[model samples]
Target: MKHRDSKDEEKVYKINGSTSSMGNNRKKKKNMQRLGGTGLSLEAFANAKSMSNKYNPAFKKKQREFYKNAKYVSKYKQSLKQQSQQIDAFSAVRPIEDQNRTRDVDEKNIKNKNKKKPSMEELYKKKREEEEQARIEREASIQAKKVGREKAEAERKATRAKMFKKTKYGQPVMKYRIEHLLQTIQSSSRISVNNSN
Candidate 1:
């Protein structure tokens, strides 16, 4: 093998001995110098400026419109929330007003009777009586349901007893077995007569 210098190596890789890596690097340096050290060509800068000028105003306008619409939506939602809260407040006050009216009527009746105001103990006793009445009603409803269930069970047992019979060996047998057998025999006879026809 022959020893080669760097110049010979460059010549071996050059395309048709006209272009080399050094030549390419020189061309790149020239291009960079022509671009004023900004690395961007003048044509690229012009194209970018035109694109930004053409699209930026429209994009900003659309952004403003979007924000305006969002503002309106939020305001409408807040108003709706306020209205619902007002309606809730009104509804809540209505029940309290009704309760106040009943209390006022009770106070008027007591005044008309020329009686002193009931003591706290008397109020507590009245509340307790109301609770006891409610408990008694609940228990009565439960007892009625229990009695209804027992009556239904008794009725079911009676129906079952009527539909079945106990043999001497104490085995329960269907009481309608003979009726079912007669029905099947009649049906078979009818079918046979029809076939004969």
Candidate 2:
């Protein structure tokens, strides 16, 4: 049984249950026949499109032409009409100030284009020099850190050995002198520990 759709076009739906996958496939075939046997998946359509493109590869040279053709050939006429009538917020032209700013930026870029360009050899030389400087700086820093750490370790061992050494004559005393600084430290036990009177 066939029925006319709201579009006045006759759409022959399966009078029986075609909800199952296999039944839906049969219905798809019937629908394809109704629409001139051109119901193809997007991938199949794209492949066919690419194959057709070989014949007239330059047909869509301008994207605007393609867009215009798309609107013209769109199935949703009412939607197309509404789109044409409505103001697209996204497509609004930039303000005058923004346009001027963009133009100024473009002019500055155009002017910059006139500047001399360094040759590949110069660029490579500059990069190599920079890398060499970075390497030298890194090595210097690492050596300085190593030297600082070694000095600190040596100092610590010397100080610790002095502090932990057995007191000479049973007196815990350590003394040292820098250029103008004299330092002294003594570890004292209880008053009765090492005193006799």
| Per-model TM-score versus the true fold | 0.28, 0.34
State in Å the error of residue 65, model 2. Answer: 9.7
RMSD (Å) per prediction: 20.3, 16.8
Writing each residue's lDDT as its tens digit, candidate 1 over 72-142 gives 99999999999999988876778877879978998999898896779999999999999999999999999
| Clash pairs for candidate 1 | none
Across residues 1-197, which tens digit of lDDT does each residue of candidate 2 receive? 87666433312233443344556788889998888978679997788778874645477566668888787778578777778766444335657787688789999999999888999999999999999999999999999999999999998888777665555587645443231133322323344465853
Best by lDDT: 1
After superposition, candidate 2 runs with Cα above 4 Å error: 1-116, 167-197
Q: Looking at candidate 1, what is the lDDT of residue 194?
A: 100
Q: Which ten residues in a row are the worst by lDDT in model 2?
A: 178-187
Candidate 2 collision pairs:
none
**Candidate 1 stretches greater than 4 Å from native:** 1-115, 166-197
lDDT on C-alpha atoms for all candidate structures: 0.85, 0.70
